[model samples]
Each structure stands twice: as structure tokens, then as C-alpha cells.
Target: MKDHLSALVQKANLGDREALEQVLLKIKDLVYNLSLKMLLFPEDAKDATQEILIKVVTHLSTFNHKSQFKTWVYRIATNYLLNHKGKRSKEFAMPFKDYTDLIDLGHSNEVRYTKNEGELSLLEEEVKVSCTQGLLLCLNEIDRMVYILTDILGFNGVEGSEILGISSENYRQKLSRSRAKVRSFLNNKCGLVNPENPCRCTKKIDFLIDQKIVNPKDLRFAHFSDRSIDLVGRIDDLEKSVAIYRSTPNFPAPEELLEEIKTTLKIN
Candidate 1:
């Protein structure tokens, strides 16, 4: 698979459009789901997913096979969503160890539940979506990525770390904290628990359990190797697809993306 991906990337570099298409097709679901998580709307997720493909088609020649294609694509998606959010979307970004590590956590106010007469009045369906997005907002960006990759996307810690640019150790810790926060917030909002102060996350354990439950690792890990370097290639492939599709608002020919792929080689 490494040799095949390497060759595919090389072909893409040489402007073999077919090779690029092959690569993009492989990760379409990943791109779309990631966009949905990032944008929190079906329309926006669809648009971003399509745009990510287009970007990959145009810029395949420039992708340098670094930082796991998935991570690279996510980074692009994250940046676009953060800096140029769509109409009606929130703009919640977080500062990081690397300012370049900016992530679209979405603004605090966007889609936040309306407490009408003291109760969140979203319809049954909207409630799930709203609560999910609200829960996502509470997490710091990296933690959010880890949560989505594992919880929503199913990636393992080793692979997830590559996508989010964090250590496995940190990923575990962040995931732990994020899950606790999300579960706590959900328990309160769902009327399962009170939100007055020091949270009681006890029932969450049983809830997670009754669900056939989890300590769900970041959900997107089917293809990742146990190692980080391998994860970089996966992310590199992923980034190419994302850059083309799931932008925040306006999908521009990005500048930061050029640097993301190049950095992977330095690590390799």
C-alpha cells in the first residue's frame, strides 16, 4: 500500500489526473464526514466535500506526501472553516502550540441552544444535531479533532495523533477529558443530570456501557499503521482531498497548505 500510495502521489505530482482521482475516490467518505463534523451542517458538509475533491484535482501536483494525507486534508479543512466560515456558521478558533495549528472549533454562539422559557426548544431531530455541535464547541480544537476522528470517524490513537499533530499520550489525555466534558454536558442538557456545578459523570459510564459502550478511540483509524510516520502518509492523501472540498465559506487556493505537505518530508 505504501509503494502504491507513493507511486500514486508521484503520479499526481507529475499531473496524472487519473492517479489523483484514484486517491481522492479512496477517501471521499472521510473527507465528507470530517467536513460535516467541522461544519456541522449537511449542506455545508456536502459543499466542502465536493470542494475538497476539486482542490485535490487541481493541486495534486503540489502535495508532498507528508503529515498523513488525512491530517493534511483536515488541517486545510480546519483552517478554511476557521478563517472563512460560511454564512450563519460560527467562527470558533483556538490558539495552539503552533499558531499554524489553528483549528475551527466554531464560535460559541453559533447554533447554541436557545433557552426559551427555560428549556432548549429544538425539535427532536434538531436536538441531537444541536447538542452534538454544542458538545464539539466545548472541546479545544485538537481534542475535538481527536474526538471526531475516534468517536465519529473511528481512528485509533496512533493514527489520530498524526491527524491532529499530537502525541499518542496527549491524544489519550485529550480524548479522555473531551469525552468527560461532552458526556457531562450531554447529561445535563439531556436532562439526565443537573448542571449547577461540579459535574456528576457517573451515569455516563452506565450510559456509555448500555450502548455497548465505549472508551471509543478517535473513530477514523481503519487504515492507520501503529506508527506516526505511516499516519502522515495517510493524512497527506487525506489533505489533498479535503483542500479541494470542505472549506469554511469561500474555498480559495490556500497558502498554508503548501507548507503543510512540505513539512512532512522534514519529519520523514
Candidate 2:
């Protein structure tokens, strides 16, 4: 795959429009997913991804071959997101602690008696998806990017460092701090991490449903049948816990969006 992408990059650099389009197609999902994770909103992520791709196409001729093409693309993405000045989603403004508290209060005996096991499971998945995405937002931009690259997306330290334009040591330090923060938050508040926690996804389902945060019939994250966070490969103890939340399947860029990008690039 790397060799094929390298060939595509070479052809793209040589002014082959078809190669350039293929290159964009290959990396479009990656760019969009990273933006979605970072921005925490679909529309914002879509806009950011589109902007970044345009920048990448405009600068394709300047890409030095010292790094892998994937790494270079990521560097473009990371830099774009770091400096992006856009309003964050309101969902991210609410503190995780406040979310937990709301769940605790909402999970009264009356609610528990009303919801069955299947309903509770569905709700838990929604909360897990929403809360995990929210947790990433809690980190500052750089830290958040580091955690997403290394922990979620499975980039190694060297590649992650290259993408962020930081030393490997610096990358490790940032990743450590980010991981620690997320781990602590989950252990304390997420029922998936600790059974003792009062914020079980099941308990929060009714509350989320009542507040319109989650709709039972039209579930968002819960209906993604292709992948779940559990599928992320874990290398060691550090990843064991983080993987639980980061294991969702890679989100694909919309087909129409890809076509729009292709047309904008004027590929025949």
C-alpha cells in the first residue's frame, strides 16, 4: 500500500491529474475522520477536511520525499487543524463531570424499572460514542491530536512526531499526558471503565432520550454496524483501556463530498 501510494505521489508530482485524484481519494477518509474527531461536529469536520485537501492539492508539487506520503498528508492535516479558528460544537462545552452528574440523577429507580436490557444496551453504545468523542475534545489541540494519532489511529511515535513536527520524545510526553487524562476521566466516570461508577450508559439512556441527545428509534452512533471501538488493536497495557473508547471504525468521507473534491481538482 505504501509503495502504491508512493507511486501515486510521484505521478501526482509529475502533473498527472488522474494520479492526483487517486491520491486524494485514498486519503480523503483519513483527513475527514481526523477532522471529525478533532472538531467534534460533522459539518465542521467536513469543511475542515475539504479545506485541508485543497491545500494539499495546491501544495502537492512542494512535497519533499524525505517522509512517507501518508506522514506528509497527516502533517498537512495536523497543522491545518491546529490553527483552525472555528466555533466548536456546543455539545463539547458541557463538562464531562456535569454529564456524569446528569446521568446519576437521571438514573432513578423509576427510569431503571422502565428500561429493559436491550434498550439499556442500545443507549450505552450511544453514550459511549458521544462521551468518547467528547473526551477527546477535553484535551487541548496538540495533546488531542497526539492522542488521536498514536492511540486511536495507530500511528507510531516516530510517524506521529514527524506529522506534528515534534521530537519523538516530545510526542511521547504529550501522548502520555493525554492518555493519563483520558484514562483518569474514564476510570472515574465511565461505567465501561469501572462498574462502580454511577454513570452507566444504561442509566443515562432515558436522560439522553428525554433531552433529545439520543433518539431511540433513530440512533446515530449505535447503528454503525461496520465497526466498534473494541476492534482497535492494543499493543500494551497503556492502550488496553484507551482502545476501548478509540475502537470505532474509521469514518469515511461522504461519496458526494469526494466527487465534489474530484471536480474541484478538475480531474478528468
Candidate 3:
């Protein structure tokens, strides 16, 4: 597949539309699924998907093929979303800061850092899940991009460092401290503030708040109970999780829209 992508990219760069179309068909789902996970909103996902298509079309000539095709495609999608700056631009976004401090990194920097490579890796996952709950509320746009690209997307520290234009060691250092901050926040929010203390909200909010990325409905003072938890979980576990995930209408794949975009861009 890698070799095929390399060939396709070379062909596309030389102005082969058929090769580009074949590559697009091969990667369409990978691109869509990634956007779905990151943006956490269907509209945003679709918009990002469309924007990625345009970018892939325009930038196809610039692909160096040093990374995998999948990686290059994902880079396009990430850049599209991160570039949308300003007021409520993220309103349509799954903006992490807008969520209640689900992960709590309070005032403490007591996060454990060891020289042991094995130990750093072993603790990384647990720390990531726990910290995201609290510190997501505090992370701004660029920070969220770096964290998501490295942690959630499974990009290597070095790869992530290059993408964010930082040294690998520096990225690793920041990642460790950021996770600590998030864990601290989550711990505090879940009412584990004091090792001897209890939660402020009931058991319900405690459970919901511990999730790495919770919905906006629960964050805005809307209470969810045990039954609601079960309901939400069951719905997710359903065989049709993708089919009924949202209550909103799907945007039409209108020809006029495509024609408008194509005519404006002068891409036959």
C-alpha cells in the first residue's frame, strides 16, 4: 500500500487526475473516520473532510512521500481545523476548553517524572486518560493540537514534535507536564481533591466528569443519573452506534454546491 501510494503521488504530481482519484478512493474512509473522532461533531467532520479534499488536490504536488499517505492525509485534516481561528470558530468545534474542567490539573505540579523509559511509557496511558478529564478545560487551541496529534492519534513523539515544529525532547517534556496538569484537575473535579476528601457532586457527575471527552449537555449543569449513564452506554454499545449517534439532519450532497466550489476554484 505504501509503494502504491508513492507511485500514485508521483503520478498525481505530474498531473494525473485518475491517479489522484484512485488514491482518494483508497483513503476516503480513513480520512473521514479520523475527522469524526477528532472534531466530535458531524458537521465539522464533513466540512473538514471537504476541506481536506481541496487541500489534497492543491497540495498533492508537494507531498514528499517521506511519511505514509495516511499520515499526510491526516496532516491536511488537522491543519484545516486548526487554521479556523477567532470567535466561536470553535463553537462548531469540539473545543476542549469549552468543556467544564473535566480533567482537573489544579495548582500542583507534583506529576511524577522518571528517567526510566519503560516506566514513562507504562504510566503514560493512565496519566493521559486521568489528566485529560481535568486539564482539557485549560488547554487552548495549539496545545490541544499538539496533545491530540501525539497522544490520541498515536503519532510518535518525534513525529509529533516535527509536526508541531518543536524538538522531540521538548515535546516529550511538555507532554509529561501537561498530562500531570490534567490528572490533577480530574482528581480534584472527581472529588478526589484531598486524598481524604470526597466528591462535591453526587456519584453521577463524578462518573461523567471522569470521561476524557464528555458531551456539552452534561457540562452545562444538566444532571445525568445512573439510568442515564446506562442509557448512554447502552446506546453507544449498540450495533448501530454510528447510525443514531446524533439527532441532527445530514447536509445534502448537492450538485450545485459542488459546482459552485469547482467553478470558484476552476477545478474541472
Against the true structure, whose lDDT is highest?
2
- For model 2, name the residue pairs that clash: 229-247, 229-248
Model 1 worst lDDT window (10 residues) = 240-249
- Candidate 3 versus the native: TM-score? 0.53
Give per-residue lDDT, candidate 2, residue 3: 86
Give lDDT per model, in order: 0.47, 0.76, 0.49
Q: What TM-score do all the candidates reach, one by one? A: 0.49, 0.84, 0.53
lDDT of 1 by residue, 87-167 (tens): 433443323222112112121322223335222221222222333353465556566667777765667888777765668
Q: For residues 1-268, could you state the per-residue lDDT of candidate 3 as single tens digits?
A: 8898889889878877677667766666555545544454445555666667777878887788788877777767667656644232354334344444333222222223344654333333223222322233255555656656655455788887776667888888877765565445444443323333343222222243344233323221112111121232244433221111221122233224344444544655
How high is the lDDT of residue 113 in model 3? 35
Higher-ranked by TM-score: 1 or 3: 3
Error of 3 at 17 (Å): 3.0
Clashes of 3: 14
